[model samples]
Each structure stands twice: as structure tokens, then as C-alpha cells.
Target: MATLTSTSVHTSNLFSREAIAEGTMAFRFTKPAGFEFRAGQSIDIILLNPPETDEEGNTRAFSLVSAPFDPDLMIATRMRDTAFKRVLRDAPVGMQVKLEGPSGSFVLHRKAEKAAVLLAGGIGITPFLSMVRQATNDKTQHKIYLFYSNRRPEDAPFLDVLKEVARQNPNFHLIATMTQVAQSKGEWKGETGLINEEMLAKHLPTLQGPIYYLAGPPAMVAALRRMLINAKVDADDIRTEEFSGY
Candidate 1:
């Protein structure tokens, strides 16, 4: 991705705060321009550094966690890296960050409306968070299923939010899987395994009327696409976003 270089900022500061869990911080941001976005789309973040660049330059991409219908633009960072961790933990509120987009085609199009299956792993849950949130807010009529794979319950983002949305909407189903449950917090009794075709079939039996939206590491996304195709899903019905070289 090309860096956006200019002194001007495209959006205003709506939120600059952190939500903490499992020693990780998820940064949230918002702006007023009506902040229009499709449910599963993402925005490129252009962090300004007083003209200074990071070890790999000054910009990165992040998926919006807040619903498009919501009044704010939201994104969460894991705070795992030395550089990002410091910024999320210490950055003061009201600081300006450069941003562009609300871009990407991972959003659910109308043609595959009867059913939609969303697969996410770890921080990849960000985009689907927006999709499910928007679906509930708008009262979408599509049958939506979420296959969220995390190391443990504590490792996934927005557990309560996803549960709440699933509770309110009959068309929405949220299935969470933990790859390493032994190291997880107590009281964790969800599905345990990797997100592969067998696990997907167990939770989401059929993709007959559903279009699949996948986002995660490059290998995960690519592998899941192949799984869906092998399961008889149309190639065009699967959309994805892989956050590689980050």
C-alpha cells in the first residue's frame, strides 16, 4: 500500500481510547463524516509520526470493528508488538491519526443474501464484528453464521457483543473454537479445534445459500477458500481479506 503524505487529515478524531483484555489493548477511533462503510469492509490507517517513520514505515491496515450503522469508526489493535503496544498503552486521547478508506470488497453483496457464513481467526474477527453489528442494528433478513477461531475465549475480541447479537437475532449464529484450551482461562467449554473443513461442517452444515466472507492471516484465508470450494461453494461466493506483511 502507498503511504498518504500530506499535512491535512481526512477525518476528525471521534475516538482515541483502549479496551483491555488478556494484557492486550484494542484501540478505538471514531469520526463524524457519517463514517459510511459496508459491513465487512476495512479502512487503511495512516499513522502520522511527526514525519518520522517506524521500522517499516508509518502506515498499516486495520479492519473496522464497529458497525457501519454506528455513529463512530472503530478498530482494535492487539498491543502485542513493541511499537504498537507502546502507542496503544500510552497515546493520549484526542491525538490525530491519518486515515483513508472504508475500502475493500469483503462486504456481503445482495446476490448471496439467503445465507452468509463469516470465518475469522484471532484479530481477524474485526471485520466480522462490523458485519454482525450492522446486521443486528439494521435488522438484516439474511441468515448469518460466524465461525470464530481463537486460541481461547479470552483471546477473542468482543465475546459479549457477539453473544448479544446472536441472542437478539434469530438469523445469526456464533460458534467459537479454541485451538489451545488447556492454556485458556477456566470455565471455557466451547468447541476446541482448528478452523478447517471438518470443524466448519460440524458447526455450519451447509453453505447452500450462504456466501462465505473470510479474513485473517494469508495462509488461513487461502486455505479456507479452498475448503469452501471443495465443499461445493461457488468460487465467486467466497470473499476474503488477508492482512499480510504487517
Candidate 2:
């Protein structure tokens, strides 16, 4: 993991934007010269003199969905019906925003020999997406297994992109499952139901050697941590980050 000496702030303008998933929007910004960050890091985006403000404030922190190797800095979020998102969603192409960070320690372990099992729920997949993309680009030898879960495929961001990444990286494993396939209009033949001990055992040979990273709603992260502990996985092998309000 790459640690930094200090945090810096910069002004970046919105250059492009798109809807990555249902009710989710990804905004791309100009990467200030010399601005650098490791995969799995997060940043805070502050609205500059927005047309309106709310109790939620004008600043929001988001995981860097784009990999370090990518040319631009990018972040995605669920477009909640709030003043912040409203202004963000409607902001013009050249709208400028304040950025502060490259924060959070939710990065990959250094041991390449040990496998990495990433458990991502909903938008929690953002950071892991960067990690996997970087791993593929760097040709890292670490085995990566991403188990991304959502209510349905439509709600799961970057699903197709992950599939392509898996196809390109031999060491990357992708296990995408949905909790509510019936509600989805698209057909899915992949795994269904919540990820559990049985589900993990089915794909992984032995869970003891792998380091687990969990990201999701607070409740989901807590539940997965408990499941890992109950399954005899070492406490030291587990790391967690809860994603909320985004």
C-alpha cells in the first residue's frame, strides 16, 4: 500500500459525465498536473458556490473509481435526490469543484503469494474496480477474486467492464451475484442469493490462505465479517470498509 506524507487540494473541472448504472452517475474530471493517488484511495469533492445548499452540506467523499493509470480522475455515486446531486447532475461541462484527499487506507495487501478475496456490495465495488484494473495493467502476480453483489445486474455498476477485465487478466476471478434476479428484467444465469459460507467454499479451495476485504453497507460488512470469523478465518486476514450515503 502507498502511504502519503500530506493531503493536497486541487480544483478540477467536470469534463464528462455518464450514467453507469440505474440511478448512478459517473463524473470525470480533469486531473490536475502532478496529482497522483494509489488505487483504492478516496477523495472529497466540494461543490464551489453551488446554486443551493442543504444540511448534508456541499462536500462529499467518494472512492476513486478510475485506476491510477487512467488519464483522468473519476468518481461515481448513486444520484440521490438531494441538493448536492441535483447541482452535480445538472452542472455544465466546465463546472469546477474542489477536491481534497487521496485518503483512506483501504488498499490491497503486499503479499502477492496470498490471494485477495474482495467482497463488494452495490457501489462498494468502486475501489475494488481500481485495484483489479491496476493489477491487470501492472501484471501483478497476486490472485484477485472479486465477489460483487447487488440486488440485480442493472443496479450493479461496471459489471460488463469487470467481465472484460477478467477476460484480460488470467489471475483475476469474477463472481457476480444478484439477490433479486426476479425483479430484474435482464436474464442472469450467474449465482444468486446473498454471499455466504457455502458460497465462498464453493468457489475458493481453502479460505485460510486468502486475505479478505469487505465493502458495502454497514450491515452487510458486519455480517460478512461475522461469517468469516465463524468460518475459522483469521481475524488478522480480514479488512473492512463501509460505504454509505453515496
Candidate 3:
């Protein structure tokens, strides 16, 4: 766990909200003056005067989807039928929300000499999206390879933006896979299968020195960690953040 030097809380109004994918929404909020956070960090969010609450509480931690330079604070999540998510999903513009502590160690190492292999499952792509956007905007020299898995294109969040980023940033490569192709609709051209050693090898021929970042459901993260270890990736070189539930 990374320690935060400051845990000061701030309040901001919801500037806008829109659906980015099925059951997922992208929210932009007013960025409090002097409120700063790294690209991959997460903040605790509390809906002020939420409509409902349960054993899960009224607050949730979400990765900052917007870059540090962006004027608005942004976060995205699947709109589950839970009370918290429902309140957030239907939250009106101008609603106030509490934010605290931009904490988390799941950030880019800024290693210019080494490559970064990012493995994301479903909504786990949030933090990686921020990092990749920052890297692309700054034109960082660090190479990045993103392997994002989802049921299909419609269920995958930020697919279009990521593809555009890959196109704009020569150092950034995207390998999007669909695990449930049979149930997916429309034309599919990308790879179809669960992420495995063979897929990694196919995209990353020489993964000896590259750092690995895994984010997704607990089971997926655990499985990928085991796969990477089996593939001889150094344990110290891999950093992970697990998103609970599917």
C-alpha cells in the first residue's frame, strides 16, 4: 500500500455525465483548485445526500480516468443495480460529491529503457486508460502494450478512445480480445479467446525486461499473475490492482 502525504478532502460539483458503454458511465466533475493526483491513482467518492445506502456504504473508490492536466476530475464505473451505483448513475448535474485522498501505488514507473505490458479485464481498463492518455499526451518514451479483454466490443469500455490513442502514439500498442465471441454481435476482427501465455508470447516476443501491470477482477488478476510467474516474469517487475466482482 502507498501512503498518502495528504488526505485532505474536497467537494466538487458534477459537471457532466454520459454513457460510454453498456451499463457504464463517464462522469466529469469540477476540479477543485490545487487538487492534484497522478494519472493512475484512485479517490474515495461519496455522493452527498445520496438517495440510498446499504451495508456497502455510500462511498466507493474509483480510479481517476482524467489526466492530471485535465481541468475536470473524471471517473467511470459499471452501473450496477446496487444502491450506490444507481444513485451515482442517475446523479444529476450540479450535484455535489465528496472526494478524498488521491492514493494508490499503481502508477507508471517512468522507465524509459523498459517496456510496459498492461493487462486489463473488463472495467479494469480505467487506470490504464488514464496512464496511457497521459503518456500519449506527453509523448513519453516508455513503450506500452495494452491487452484488454472483454465479452465483446459493446461491453468493452473506452475501446474507441484506446484505439485512437494507439493510432496516435506509435509507442502504444493495443491488443483487444473478446472472450465470448459466440454471444457477441456484429463483425469481429480482433482475436477471440481468454488471455493466456500464448497470447502474450505472440504479442510480446521478448518480455524479459518489460514491467507488467495487471488490473481487473480478482480471479482474472490472480490467474494472470500465475501465468506471468510461470512465464518467468520477475515478480518484482509486476504490479497489480484487483477490482472486486465481475
Candidate 4:
């Protein structure tokens, strides 16, 4: 794995906010001049004047959902009733936020000869969304296969955007699975059940040289990692990031 270097802390004013899905909000902030980060990187954000604090502290790390070329820095997170999240979700425009270090090794391998398989669960889709958007915007020729899982369509963030991206980018493919198919409201026409070896084999043309990326809750990440290893995937070719809590 590669090491990431830390940069100077910067303060950014909140530009805008919107509810992207149920209990989830996308926050856009002014990007500090000269600040740059690779797709899939995350930053530490601190509410300048939070209404309250707790054992979780005032700062939270979130993956950058905005593309590198975007003028504003953006992140999406589930709006739990926690003190930190509550303050973030209710903060108004022009609120100043402290941002520190854009650091992470979970970025795409631009020069890889094989295809990339991205496995995301729930809100874990944030980083992969960043990578896919960047790849599409830059017109990079990296072949990407994203397998995103959620309980319901309403709970999945960026579902519509990702579907549109796949439609426009020939090199990118998306396979969305719903674990709670019984709860589906309408006629759903996509893969169902948790991602497993059979599902992978059905979609992946050949798994010979593909690299796998997994992101989600701790248990989900661990389970997927083991599943990949059991399928004879090289350990070095698998990368993962665990999103602990809301």
C-alpha cells in the first residue's frame, strides 16, 4: 500500500447543501486555493461552531464525492441524530468549516493492465463514486465494474447519477443489487441478493487479472475480503476501506 502525506489545514465556507436521499445530505464547500487531492481521498472536517460535541469528537472523516475538477469540495454523509452530524446537517450556508489533510491510499490504479472491480455497500459508495465520476469526466480509458449493494433503492445514494454515468461511459459498468427484494415497492429488474462468487462470475467476463476494491461497514468489508481470497484472488490485488459509523 502507498502512504499519503498530510497538508496544511484550511478553512472553507459552506457553499450549499442538499438532501440527496433519505437521511443523507450532500454538502459543498469552497475549495481552498492550491488544494488538490486524488479521487477516493478523504478529509477531516470540523464544524467551526458546532451546537454540541460528544465522545465521537467534533471532526469526522468523509470521502470526497466531488470530482477533482469540480470547483467546490463536496462530501455526502448519512444524517444521524448525533451531535456532530446534527450540526452539519442543520448548518446554514456560509458556515465556516475546518478541513485537514486529504489522505488515503484507496485510489484507482491508472496504469493497471487489468480491469477494476469496485464493491460498495450502503454509504460506502462515496469513494467509488468519486473515482467513477473522475474517470468519466477525464475520459480515462480505465475499465471499471462497480457492484453496489443496498437494502432498497431509496436508501442508495447516487443511484441515479451512477446509472447515468454507466450509460454514458462505455468503459464503466454498474451492477446494483438489493438485499431486501421483498420490500421493493415496484417492479424491480436487477440482480438480487448479496454479492457472492456466483454473482461475480456471472458479470465479470474473466477474473484472471482484475483487482478488487471493497468499501462498507467493517463486517461487510471483512466478509467480502474473505470471499475474494477464497475465490483465489491475489491478496495484494485487493484493497479495502471500512466505514465504521454514521
Candidate 5:
């Protein structure tokens, strides 16, 4: 568990934040003072407090949604509790918060020896967002497949941006699924089930030479890991980041 003790060099909140998704907030820490990290990495946020912890007694963990060379530190967060939800949901312009690290072990392989298949569930799309943003920004010719799952069309973060990426970039393939569509609009025509082996095979029939990066809730990660293994995806080729309510 990392603490909130930033060394002052990495603290910056001069940018704005917006609600990109229903329960998600995206902040642009412009040229974040001392924040330097890989595109697929994440960070820890230390909320202001009076020494009293929340019911969970934990800080927040979020993934960087911007590329490393974007000249700004972009992190997307999912506010799931009263404490964080209140702060993020009601955050006005110019509000400041604490953030640290470009943390995490999940990143795009730089050696060019391994390709990647990124799997994201709902708000878990943060890390993969960074990877895609980096790759797209750099115009790298890597074969990447992004499988993003959400409850419905409206729940999917960066929906339009992803569709545009898929439209413009042949190196990226973005597929989506909606588990429940009670609130979905009429424009959605994609799949409507949890990510499964069959879905993977259907979209990425040639899953021969790519690694897998999975990020999402614990249950989604666990179930998807099992399914990937059962589908003969090498365990070593799969990297996961579980959002455990930290």
C-alpha cells in the first residue's frame, strides 16, 4: 500500500476534469510536475483528509489514460464509494487533488517481439486507453486488439473516440459488448454478452502471436483469466490489473 506523501515535485492540478463515463472521471494534470510513466502504467491518488480514513481506509488507484508523450498526465477514475464519488462527482473546475506514480506492471512490450490483445471491462479501460493512445499517437505498427465490455452503450467510456480509432486505424481492432441494455439507445448493434472464448474467437480468430492485457473488476478478471486459459491462451502472455477497491 503506497502512501500519499508526494515529494512536491509530482504534484500538479492546474488542469480540468470531466465526466467521461457514468461513474468515471478523467483529469488532465498538464505537464504533471514529476509524473513520468509508461503509457500502460497507472497511478495512486491521495485524497485530502483530516487523518480520518474512509470506511475502507484506502486511497484510490487509477490508470493513466493519456500517452506518455502527451505533454499532460491523464488519469481516468471510477468513483464507486461515497467518499470518492462525492469528490469526483461534485468536483468543480480548478479543484486540486493529489496524485502519484506511473505505477503497475502491465505495459505494452517494447521489444517488438510480442504483440498484444488488450481486454477491458467498463471503467477498466483506463490502462488500455493509455496504450492505445500511445500507439496511435506514435503511429506504431503493432497488431493490437481491444475487447471492451460494458453494461450498455451509454456505460462505455470513450465510446465515440474508440469508434473513431477503429475507423481510422487498421492496426487497431476495437470490439465491444454490452451485458445489459435496458438503458441502451437504439444505435448500438454490437454483441450483448460478457466476454467469452467464443467472442474472442469470433473477433480475433487468429490469436496466435499476441499477449493479453486484462483489466477490470475482480470477478471479471478472474472469470476472464480462466476463460482465456481454457481457450489455450498462454498464461505467460496474459497480464491483468484488478481494480480491488483500493
Candidate 6:
């Protein structure tokens, strides 16, 4: 699939920042005039005149978490102790940043007849969240199955939002699992353990028909891809995007 050439760049100010999960934060930025992007896209945010610098530099790429119809652009990440994250975490509401292209081809399949099976781990749910939101808003006919795995309920970002989305969109099915729910203080009753072929078979009618989308750390993405391939799903139907982290 061809990706959008991100030639457009704009200067935007931070709108708000809030913690949505344990050690995770969602940052909203004012969208520049005439700026438009697909649901599953990413952008490079360049910090301007930071108080400090590091080997990672000032630019970081983040998936767009906010839907296209949202009032602003948003990105979420685990707040590490890195210089960039620290700056972003403490950034004033009106701080300026350079917003680069809405790059990446890891988007939803348009065929309404075929289903979309999304495998997301940790913070990798960003793009899928945008896609689900847009689908609900547009009243799309495509069926979506989201299998989101996290360490714990507290560790899962946007869990409540996704549950609400599931309630609002009948075409959207969410199966959120926890790999280490026992370690969490909060109560969880959903499926537990790493997402596997058996779990998928229980929820999905058949894995071979739907297009699969995977996103997460390198290891998780590779494992999910291998699982799909091992299940005899067509390799041509699998698409993946690995989040190396900011």
C-alpha cells in the first residue's frame, strides 16, 4: 500500500496533557489550519528550545491517537525519564512544537465485507483507537475485533474509553486481556494471559477471512505475526507496525 508523502509541516501549541494510565500520558495539540490526516497515521513532534538535550535528540515520532474529527491532534506515550518525555510532560499548555507529516500506511482495510482484527499491546493501541473512533462516528459497516493485551488493567491505556466505544458501536468488538492481572490491585474479569490462537478462535468466527493488524513492541509484533502465519492465515492479509518507543 502507498503511504502519504508527509511534506506538510506546521507549528502547533500544546493544548492539554493528562495521565490516562499508569506512567502513560496523552497529550493534545491544537491542529493547524487546513491540516488533515487519516485515522491510523503518525507525526514527528520536534521540541523547540528545550531546557536540556540528550542523545535521543528533540524529535520523536508518535501515532495519532485522536480521530480526524476531533477538535485537536493527540498522542499518547509511556512517560519515561528520558529528556524528551520529561520536557513534554512538563511542557506548558501553550508551548510550541514542530508538527511533521502524518506518515505511515498501517491503516484500516476499506472493504466492509472483510473484518478487521486488531492485535495491540501496551501503548500500541493508539492508531486502532483512532480508527475505532472514526468508524463509530462515521457509522461504518466494517466489523472490527480488537484484542488488546496489557500487563494489567491499570497498565492499559484508554481501557475505559474502549469499553465505552464497544457499547456505542455494535460492529466493534473488544477483547481486552491482561497478561499479569494478578499483579494488579484493581479487579479484572476479562480474558487473561497472552493472546493466543485458542483465545482468538473462541471469539472470532474464523481467522483466515479477516485482515490482521498488529502493533506494539518489536517482540510482541513479531510474535503476533508468527501466530497468524502459523494459523495458516495468508501472509498478504497481515499488516504490522512496530513501535520502538519515543
Tens digit of lDDT per residue, candidate 5, span 158-193?
A: 988888877777888998888887676756688878
Question: Please, what is the TM-score per model?
Answer: 0.87, 0.97, 0.95, 0.95, 0.87, 0.97
lDDT of 6 by residue, 107-164 (tens): 8888889999999999999999999999999999999999999999999999999999
lDDT of 6: 0.92
Give the clashing pairs for model 3: none
Candidate 6, pairs of clashing residues = none
Model 2 Cα RMSD, 1 decimal: 1.3
Model 4, residue 50: C-alpha shift (Å): 1.2
Q: Candidate 5 — which residues are off by over 4 angstroms? A: 1-9, 50-53
lDDT of 1 by residue, 1-246 (tens): 212221223654535665644655566676646456677666766665633445865567788887766767778767756564465456667667777776776776665356888899888888888888787877878888899988878888788788898999998999888898899766677788887777777767575557888888898898888888887888977888897853
Pull out the clashing pairs in model 5.
none
* Per-residue accuracy of model 4 over 64-145 as CA lDDT, tens digit each: 8998888999899888889998888778889998998688888998774679999999889999999999999988888899
For residues 99-151, what per-residue lDDT tens digits would candidate 2 score against the true structure?
Answer: 99888888888889999999999988989999999999999999998999999
Using alpha carbons, what is the TM-score of model 6? 0.97
191: Cα error in model 5, Å: 2.1
- Backbone clashes, candidate 2: 0
Task: Give lDDT: candidate 6, residue 157.
Answer: 98
Query: What TM-score does candidate 3 get on C-alpha atoms?
Result: 0.95
Q: Candidate 4: list runs displaced more than 4 Å.
A: 1-3
